[model samples]
Target: MVSSFHVDARALALVGSHATCETEHVPETRRRVVAVVGPTAAGKTALSVALCQRIGGEVVNGDAVQLFRGMDIGSAKAEPAERAGVPHHLLDVLDVTQEANVAEFQRDARAAIDAVRSRGATPVLVGGSSLYVRAVLDPLDFPGTDPAVRARWSAELESRGPEALHAVLEERDPQAAAQILPSNGRRIVRALEVVELTGRPFTAAMPGYRSVYDDLVMIGLSVPRDVLDARIEKRVAQMWADGFVEEVRTLRAQGLERSMTASRALGYQQVLAYLRGEIGEHEAIAQTTAGTRKFARRQERMFRKDPRISWLDVDDHALVERAVALASSA
Candidate 1:
């Protein structure tokens, strides 16, 4: 959670403030790094495209899953038509066999932002995950990884399972453990590794709410919890209808199960379990829906802690226009 002290007064004022129709063109000198953030299935992709069209902007992918190629349908990646021709950077850049590194993403996303700015366009960073977004926007530095130390934790995880490791994390850094799910062994192992390598609590490595960019505008989409849950169910249903299972099957053949990050993705993980005869297809879908809802709640909790975010109702009819006004005025 980002501290309230980092909130930008000018940015927060955009929450309910109105802007005239003529306020379409944001001066290049005042162009801000606009971020569209919220829980999953909250219409962030649509909002991002609308903002880009309204403000001569390009998108820089902040969602870690969207960075991988061939994982499109499950990741909810925007189709080319959905993007509406707005140039998107960092989408489909990595193979499923590779891990998604936050530090690498931070470097690549910042470069994309600079490149977009050089082209006289605002870089709209769009994603649902809080850490990935902050990695690009905030001055957060990740602790170095030790392969041997990481291996030790990984071996322990395989033997004792994620819950045991999470118990350990809870004892060492309760704050970090509370934020990460017990089922997520990869993140748990990484947090434990950080704790050991830094000789401090994992939470201690996380910085306060301080952004690297001065001209930044964060727009959050607020949805009722029930509505968001319904949306997640609908989304998971649509993914199945869109051959999500087939997509996972194809990726699995290409060594997706060996990849630490890609294999653990939301729908992919449950689907993999089903494919391996661990569960039925119906159970897979149910788990995906339930897991997505849980993840969305976590996303909302994390975003709500950031005071700089100016939130608007997801159902707002004038969302794009208002966001434009907010960005232009900021």
Candidate 2:
């Protein structure tokens, strides 16, 4: 099923707090950072624009792919016309050739929030990327790396297979090993590096991830499972109709295959498989839809883990009214 943001306002207020410093200003106060989160095709972009219209706020791109240039159609990125004159940050800020990560996203997003507040406008973060959500709203407790530790793991990954090294972690820290997939060379290596430096499993040491926003308001959008699945399929179809294959071809022609991470994103990955004749057009569409559905499920799980987000099971609901009320009270 699609995500159900059944979390009430009271639950949100009670659960969204820790003993950390009160960095989140009061709603209607200066520098308010409101977050809009949900699964794919859940209408977050529309809600964000609505919030901006009512609250004098600006939109910040929190999705991972929307950062890259020429990555528009496949990313399901908010378009210039769809944005409706809202000032957006972090969209099209990187070339497909440049690698971007969570740290960079956090830094850029925080700066955008600060800048919007300086201009006397509220800052509203909008997108489905939950890691980005946690990085800014609730940061995980990942310590700065020791270069020696990182180097050690890096060297090992080069010489030894990831499985052999992951076996080493499975002995010392099974929890960390389980979390790091064998296919995920980067995260697996980082997990082992953290283990070497701190002598503690990375998974075991993750309890310190805390929310930085005080009195923060969150509105999550959810649709029924079947409805969301249909929406995902429809979106994939529309993307193809809107020239998604051409986008992939252009990126490939520009040598963007070197940036495998960007190319592996939802539609692009399936398109590449089709390009290589590994899959036909029908299979490619099915794979992309299935992958998107899976990613949406992951997004739902991610949002549910954050007690701060009160899920809204949207149907024929009046979101603008709810959003306006939240903004006014905030």
Count the clashes in each prediction: 0, 4
Give the per-residue lDDT of model 1 (tens digit) for 1-330.
Answer: 112112122311212222222324567523579999999999999998788777777788788898778999999999877777677777876778888788877877787788778767788999999988998999888999899999999999989998999999999999999999888889999999999998888878677887899989899999999999999999999999999999999999999987778998999999999999999999999999998999999999999999999999988888887888777773
Report lDDT (CA) for all predictions: 0.84, 0.72
The local distance difference test score of model 1 is 0.84
Candidate 1 ranges with C-alpha deviation above 4 Å = 1-23, 28-30
Stretches off by above 4 angstroms in model 2 are: 1-30, 144-189, 204-210
Residue 27, model 2: Cα distance from true site in angstroms: 8.3
Each model's TM-score?
0.92, 0.80
Error of 2 at 103 (Å): 1.4
Best by lDDT: 1
Error of 1 at 21 (Å): 15
Tens-place lDDT per residue, model 2, 1-330, is 111111122211211112232223335644667889999998898888767766777787788788778999998887766777767777776667665566656766776776777887778888887667777776565656777777788678768866778788788888777555454455677778777777788776454435676646787887888999998989999999999999988988876665545765778878988988889988988888987888888788767777767677667477776775665564
